[model samples]
Target: MNTTANHTSPPAPRVSKTRRRLPVLILAALLAAVPAHHALADKNDHIEARELLKRGEIVPLARILEVVQQRVPGDVIEVELEREDGLWEYKVKVLTPTGRVRKLYLDARNGVVLKIKDD
Candidate 1:
């Protein structure tokens, strides 16, 4: 009988504990962050018009009265926007530049002077 050389198979490659756990941990973290991001985006997306009005975008009543006093050179006792008969208009009651109580109507769309009554 002839003696033959014995061949042995190589061992399987080893996987580190850290490498196996890291990917699963990272995937779990990413999934958790997704819903939190969506909730934040939804909360900030829309605002109401009434809420906007309170936040100083629309003209303030005090400032409008001040402008009337400066331009007309008299005390503006009252200012209001009212629907008159069937029309929407700004009704401004002022102690005029001439020291008379005057009522004026301004066109809402263009701010053009419409009518003036001094009393």
Candidate 2:
């Protein structure tokens, strides 16, 4: 009797091609969706701005300019309301204490300073 034990070859290494592709596919889909999502978000933000204006929640453009000028005590080169991340806010470009251009963002509803970027 030949004592030869049957040696079963180890199972082949599993190559999870689908699993690897899943993350890649998800990333590609998200990248492709970003621009479309941004465009829709912008459109919605515009609608929100119109609604806020109708509701009188936003200060008048001229009034905002006056307030910024009064508070900053400088010449305002430009005053405009910008929508960022779907929220409407004010941006004031002013010449500040050192005579350098500065940009500030204020809350549209309450006139509170949200941000100030100075040169």
Candidate 3:
């Protein structure tokens, strides 16, 4: 007759409720924060644009386009306002007379070409 007792390792220590829930709580908080971040990014640009227009701090798009066209003599394809180095800038992408694409970075407050990049 077999008399040797079977050997089995003891079960692991049970985790406390808080310890088990900590990871879940952290994940939930992170998930909740993501949407807020996206919403703020989406809202800030439009809000700034509207405020600049309301306060006459930024020229109208038509004026910007006209100035850019005068300098580059091209078709304006895309325009965007961006903030860089605590300054507002307008970026314009144009297809020029020679069929070359150029990106023009303009000062948003006044129509000035900050940079021109070939694309």
Candidate 4:
């Protein structure tokens, strides 16, 4: 009878609980920061818009709505202030008496109607 010894490699080192949780904790932190960053950005946008209005760079919504009403007699539904091609514009949507919606693009600085489209 021959005596043979079975040689097995030692088990790998066990990972600590903190080491396992490091990646998860980092991911959670990154996810939490995303919404906070967005909130700060939204607040900054409001501040910039207010500054523009105060500086007369962009006209007020009330004035823009008045101009829109004269051209399209409808219930004002929605309005959005957007910047395009380095120019500020007001995109206005109106629901007309004929049950049709019209989208109006206007120059935000002076409330000049730039284009109107039926929707």
Model 3: how far residue 108 lies from native, Å: 0.5
Q: Which of the two, 1 or 4, has more TM-score?
A: 4
Considering lDDT, where higher is better, how would the candidates rank from best to worst?
4, 3, 2, 1
Whole-model lDDT for model 2 versus the true structure? 0.60
TM-score of 4: 0.63
Tens-digit lDDT string for candidate 3 (43-91): 3455556667678776766677777888787666656666667666677
Tell me which of candidates 2 and 4 scores higher on lDDT: 4
TM-score-based ranking? 4, 3, 2, 1
Q: Each model's RMSD to truth, in Å?
A: 28.8, 18.8, 18.3, 18.9
What does the lDDT read for residue 41 in candidate 1?
35
Q: Write the per-residue lDDT of candidate 1 for residues 40-112, one digit (tens) a residue.
A: 2333222321232356333433344444555566555555444355543455676654677887766433445
- Over 1-119, each residue of candidate 4 has an lDDT whose tens digit, in order, gives 76888889999999975576455434322222122124333434655666778899988766887898899986766666667777878777788889999999899899999999997
Score residue 111 of candidate 2 by CA lDDT: 78
> Could you give me the TM-score of model 2 versus the true structure?
0.50
**Model 4 — which ten-residue stretch has the worst lDDT?**
28-37
**What lDDT is reached at residue 63 by model 4?**
85
Better of 1 and 3 by lDDT: 3
Question: Could you estimate the TM-score for every candidate?
Answer: 0.40, 0.50, 0.60, 0.63
Range of the 10 consecutive residues with the lowest summed lDDT in candidate 2: 28-37
- Candidate 4 Cα errors over 4 Å, as ranges: 1-44
Off by over 4 Å in 1: 1-67
**Global lDDT of model 4:** 0.70
lDDT values of the candidates? 0.48, 0.60, 0.65, 0.70
